[model samples]
Target: MAGRLVLDGGTVVTMDGVRTEYASGHVVVENGRIAAVGPGPAPAVDGAQVVDVRGCVVTPGLVNTHHHLYQWVTRGLAVDATLFEWLTTLYPVWGCIDEETVGAAATAGLGWLARTGCTTTMDHHYVFPADGGDVLGAEVEAARVVGLRFMLTRGSMDLGRSAGGLPPDHVVEGIDQILGATSEAVDRFHDPSADSMLRVGVAPCSPFSVTTQLLTEAASLARDKGVRLHTHLAETLDEDTFCRERFGCGPVDYMASLGWLGDDVWFGHGVHLDDSAIALMAATGTGVAHCPSSNARLGAGIARLRDLKDAGVPVGLGVDGAASNEASSLLEEARHALLFARARGGPQALTVRDALEVATIGGARVLGWDEQIGSLEVGKQGDVAVWRVDTLAHVDIVDRVAALVLGDRPPLELLLVAGEPVVERDRLVRVDEQQVTDASREAGRRLLVKAGVAG
Candidate 1:
């Protein structure tokens, strides 16, 4: 458990600056760090666990910057509504959530992520029903069963409809309770080391769902604990209007006044940000989690990703929440990002390599984990995934990256985290697949019944 392993005879595609690909390459993993990466005739094959991946495409495991893993239970319930309508349609069902339901749903969602080649993911969970018993701990336990690198955000929504916010009163918490729970989560669950697997972030839900004071204090607490902060901002025109009316300032200016414009923060669904906001983000080294599929699903506008990247902003790809996107597949999200970007700003706005980089290195960088686990390079973590390129989904493709992004779903062979296999041949290894599916379906049934919509 504490030695090196050599994955030789594979097509290692490192999403480095050049998107380098090495045929018949060997990746040496020692003490969890990639010792070297090159062709065969590598050092130390004497006692290492040699995985001969001759025909597999070995690359860094996909990184997901945003998710609401508990939304797995509400996937089909809010199918064709906009952001506001969708939230209103699903809030009643979500109000019935308990810790047990969230645990089961999150486990299934994270397992799906692993099956699609994701090793690291950040969950943005904000719903806190009045009756839910310690939902945060339940999601955390689910991550352990799912067996992936996790960024668990202690997400809070303090402003309810009584205060002119979107969420119902029963789903929101007190400001003191929110901040107190966040600090407790940081002290208990947050890992601040270089080799940590479970890192915690302070997230104040969104501008509409939380007060300005909550954002300021959340940022302060995150900085004091040296953890990352995340939330939603400027997702749609309605959100922009809410910010202007409620805060008496635009989203960017409000965040700036709260000292939230910094490198350790990343906002989700940044589709409605203006040029000046982009400039401020670039100057402050702040990051954005671009959710292309969720935007299209909810009819939200396209994010100016190429513009953001051009302005030197850190842009990462996310699937958002499964309730909006229908599923949490990193490869599917990458494909959507490429096609969606081309649809907005012409064909060259985003390339296959750029899309791939967003799912891998860019996401890691956004979560501030690039140094430990992003690309298959020397001194990086051994988080590798093997997707089968021999199938019809990848047939007759000259460009390997195109074979992945442009075609149908490629058959996955294996996915690893820290050199340990979590997915093998397109199946999850850490969970009982059928059990999780049954649990999620049952939870959905209960929710539907509680909402008086079940047949």
Candidate 2:
């Protein structure tokens, strides 16, 4: 089981620089890294585990650039609320969450993501109760149970409603506590090695929910520790107005003034950015995690994905939070990205392959993990997702990539991280799916009761 893994006789869609495709190919994984990927018969090796993926399409495992895994239990809440209203309604409920709820929600959310073919994911969990013990650690435990490569953001929100922020005071942490815990998290959990299964990031919620001081300090700390920075930026017009009135500048200008525009930073839901802001992002190599489904669900305008890509900005896809998206399937999120782009422009706006790229390599780039993941090339991590093309949803598929985007969700036959199977035969291999669901449901009920919400 620790030796080479051969995926034989599948259509390999390598999201390499040239966007190569092999009608019939073999992929070899050894020691958690891709050893070979080429056409025709695979080289036989003694004691290698060969998985016959005939009649399937194999692609680099999807990477989810942004998520709020702790919000998994809050799906369908504030269904009719906009961005601000939704946060206002749910802050109290999220504040009621403790270590147990965080673990359950993360387990369920990460399981859902893994089932949907995501290998690497980033979670922007900014909500933490004043007494919530080891919230980030609980999420890491869940990721270990799900066996997904996780980049857990040590997200902090120091400003509260009393201080003109969206969250309540009890949910926001002190700036000192935030910085100290973030430093500890980076030192304890973040692994800079190429094959690390877990990493940490510093995210200070957003400009509206955090102080300028917290943002600057968090960025500095992240840089000092050699980690990455993330937050929500230009997600809505209200945020733009907040920046204009509060900071006397636009979101992009304020960010740059604080040394936030850099290759090590990525922002979520960049829907309202203008031409100059896009140019800044392109120049600084700052990436965007486009949550098209969540944006549409909350009535936020569609992001200018086409414009961002053409500007040389690294663009990726995210399912966002379960509360906003009401779903956590990265593969389905790709379809939403394609449709949203076409709706923004014409039918030629975002191609199917473009959507796939955003879900795969582009996401890896957004997380600054492109060198280790995102493609089926040799020396990259052996993370792959296998979809059955012979399924009923893809019966008449002429173009495999287009079919993947436009067709119904194909059965995810297998998903592997570091050459180890996490999901196989349409089932999660590491954790009991039913147990995760039950625990999450129970914890959600308790949280709603504690928050005084009748469910």
* TM-score winner: 2
RMSD of each: 1.6, 1.0
TM-score of each: 0.96, 0.99
Q: 1-455, model 2: which lDDT tens digit per residue?
A: 45788999988999999999998999999988899999997999667999899888999999999899989998889899889999999998998889999999999999999999999999998887778888889999999989999998999898998999888898899999899989999988998887799999999999989999999999999999999999999999999999999999999999999999999999999999999999999999999999999999998899999999999999999999999987788999999999989998999999999999999999999999999999999999999999988877896898888778889888888999999888998899999888988999998889888999965
Model 2 misplaced regions, further than 4 Å: none
Give one digit per residue, the lDDT tens place, for model 1 in 1-455. 34778877877888877777886687888877788888765676667887777766788999999999888988887687899999988877888888988998899899998988899999988888878888889988988887899999999988889989999888888999999888999899988777788999999999888987888888989999999999998889899998898778888888999999888999898898899999999999999999999999999889999998899889888988899988678899889998988999999999998898888999999999988888998877778888778776675787777888787878778777877778888898878899999999898888778778787
Worst 10 residues of 1 by lDDT: 38-47
Global lDDT of model 1? 0.86
- Candidate 2: worst 10 consecutive residues by lDDT? 125-134
